[model samples]
Target: ATTATGGTVPLTDALELAQQGLPWLMVFDHAGVPLHLGRTKRLATPAQRLALIAALRGCSRPGCDAPASLCAVHHVRDWNTHGDTDIENLTLACDRCHAMVHDGPGGWKTVTLDQDSQFPGRTGWIAPPHIDPTATPRVNHRHHTSELLATTLARIHEQRNQEREQRQRWLSSHTRHTHAA
Candidate 1:
């Protein structure tokens, strides 16, 4: 497929390229019948890019410090994988980091953390098992240190609360057994 810049893009990348550049795309069935218009939630508009810049602040790859201005909006689920261009499915990634993501075993993976996670609505990077044995998905807090601190404190508080509850349960159970005795 050809882009508006007169450059040729692979068929797999055409949708993403069009989403970033074209206002809308029309689809036709094999018989030339009109299909669906693709303008809805398929383009990463300027507003969406700005929102991503504010949220991600920079490349979503963990430990990468590339600034947001030097990054491109990337689909977390991937355009070819039926991923929409919505803001929630988007994150910023530098050229280097962007190329590192793929379906291969050595490639990196990006996902949107669930709302109940330590970092909700954030892009998480899962490294290959060779790089990280546990394959834990981690977020980059380089551009937003405050969030790192906040999440850490929240985890500590939650752990302490769980410990306290466990202790209370043990004490209550011991007291009941003593009374029964």
Candidate 2:
């Protein structure tokens, strides 16, 4: 199979299932060609949104600190032109950057660079080959640290809730025994 980057790679059914799930949106090409990006009928799923929020943090543009909450989910590929509303093809963009992407001064395009196992779903932008003399790739560092912290906090909350429930059950049993006596 071929990736968006035009590289040849072997894709297994297991890999695809592990990668994306069809809930609200999906696209299929029965012609046996995936030259163009797939399209989505609905917006991103909640899980997909959360994943992108953690992954992209905020705006995928370099140096933009717009929080994911305030930013809009953008289609890296044009929505009208075969872009799917999946997490893989979606990124967060604040009002200004979102406009710039669609109507910027020099014409820029958003692209998803292959991130290491360390970071998943990271987004980026690149100039057209003709526009960019060197075509350097840029990575956004918005949510990297925050996401790690968030994960730790979530674990703590879960543990606390479990402990609280356990304690409440014990207290209830003790009170019943005391009243019976």
Candidate 3:
């Protein structure tokens, strides 16, 4: 497909080009090391890249349901600080979550399973500033409750009713004005 830049390139063509002529070998002379193609020049085997992409196809956050294509690949540890460009250290985060990670006043924090007893076998990752440091983090069950779902449905119904009432009032006023004219 052609990009906005008007350059047309097929995936097959790009892959064929990448495979041709030992590209990594050519680039190694400039940097004195085998360079990884995608994330930050750190050496990554093809298998690792594929795994990372698969992991990113779903939302990086533990409970978030956002699709991977809607998210950005984030460095769990900042890349510039000598963080390894490995799948284990990378995550896919939605834009809001990604921004919360980097720009929050206290910075982002991740709780490994070993660190927290409550979230055993799962890494608890939290976006900063919104997270309360002093309070123990707990999963919000209310967000998943049937009552909450019903409440949301009721609110939507109420809004539609208000809109219908407003429309009826407008039509009545217009009709009266037409009759008078």
Candidate 4:
């Protein structure tokens, strides 16, 4: 088996080395704490780890659909500011969401989903408003006459359908060849 550092050794070789009964030393972190070869405790308790996993099961950012495996663990409270390693201060977010959280100019607007308040009101995943609404009534597009626009949209939709059919046929032929092989 290969160790995390990329060094490989045979299992029999390792067992023989262990059987020799040489004095072994195990170190934890940069601390001088020592332990026997087979003795080690996890950094986080089982409950704490499970809580982290639960938080990651859904995207931490509002309205995101990315799953746990595609997300990263984030600290609600800054870790450098002496935040505890408890589950309450941890969250999981996708890379895009995480970047948005730390962005400045077009940054994310974070809010707790607690019972007290609801963020984003009706639209859960929209950019923040920057301009005031105009006092004048909005123009209705249906009243406008634009035959060219309708024809263009229809042609685009037809082309998309044809491309989809071609992709499906390619996939079917590839599957048949794989089964024959």
Candidate 5:
């Protein structure tokens, strides 16, 4: 494993550094020659997706009203363009927003922001040569609105609790039926 400074260390040490917030490059070497390119087939795991939904609460598009379950995970950068498939690059977008990202009226650039109007998180901006060059760029905030976020969290908790209770009831009914048999 190599740190950003070009110093080599054990893989465990590199992972520890990364967990501590230091970015590291993953490289494959053969005979002291670099063999791997800076690309990865990354996808947010199911657990990560659930956590992301709980965090953001829904689609990240500013005006979108779609719920998290109805949104699709989007990569900020295209994998073809050598983007990593990780949470750092992932956000949920509704179908319309996703279409605008891939094929749109104006070219859209996905961005990670320090802070935004809705939240201090990810965003998207229109690039030059856009259809409405005179229009002010707008950022989507469906997932970033603090007010909606609170409600979303409540909804998620309620949904989970309901599902848990349903499962428990099913299990108890099954157990009772088995004992009677």
Candidate 6:
């Protein structure tokens, strides 16, 4: 690996330096090239990285609190699996979380949630079957407390509205039957 100044450094050493809050290091791709290109189909551009940083405050995996600066641009669908480098298919994941994602039985799987999801257009991490029998997808709200609160409040409100509607229908039917009798 090479730092932004063109000094060659081992990958593990670079990671350690970054964790120590080194402000000058720039992450490079597997080819040891800096990922600053504005238009690249493989690596994310600077603008794309900024967009992801804006959208996700930290790693998208559950129980992780790594900040966006320490996170890498990850492909929700594996790049080797014919997934494109589109912004919609990308997410932020810390190095540890990124390594945990795979197709193996014990690995975590990530998916892009739809509009109907609690966190639309976000990455949802699905646990292995042994961890969750139903394989339910979960989002990391650790970085966004307001979103969690909003989702909880919306669910509660929807449930109450449904119950109220059901009760009104029952009362209307009962009144109609009484009048007919």
Ranking by TM-score: 6, 1, 2, 5, 3, 4
Instruction: Mark the 10 consecutive residues where model 6 has the least summed lDDT.
Output: 30-39
lDDT of each: 0.77, 0.62, 0.51, 0.47, 0.60, 0.76
Clashes of each: 0, 0, 0, 0, 4, 0
**Candidate 4 segments exceeding 4 Å error:** 1-49, 109-181
Over 4 Å off, model 3: 1-49, 103-106, 111-123, 135-181
Candidate 5 residues lying further than 4 Å off, grouped into runs, are 1-44, 103-105, 115-119, 127-139, 147-181
Cα deviation at 20, candidate 6, in Å, is 27
Model 4 quality (TM-score): 0.37
TM-score of 2: 0.48
The TM-scores, one per candidate, come to: 0.62, 0.48, 0.39, 0.37, 0.46, 0.64
Q: List the residue pairs that clash in candidate 3.
A: none
Q: Candidate 5's residue-wise lDDT over 60-108, tens digit each? A: 7667777777778788777688777776677777787777775445655
Between candidates 3 and 6, the TM-score winner? 6
* Steric clash pairs (candidate 1): none
lDDT tens digits by residue: candidate 1, 35-135: 55554573448757755654555788999988877899899999999999887898899999999999986999999999788777778999998898888
Local lDDT at 46 for model 1: 74
lDDT by residue for model 4 (1-181), tens: 2222224469677556656873332322211122223424454644443344332344555456666566667665557767566655666666887776543555454332343332111112223334212211111112112334665788999999999999999999999999999
Name every residue pair that clashes in candidate 5: 61-140, 61-141, 62-140, 62-141
Pairs of residues at least 3 apart in sequence or in different chains that clash in candidate 6 = none
Alpha-carbon lDDT of model 6: 0.76
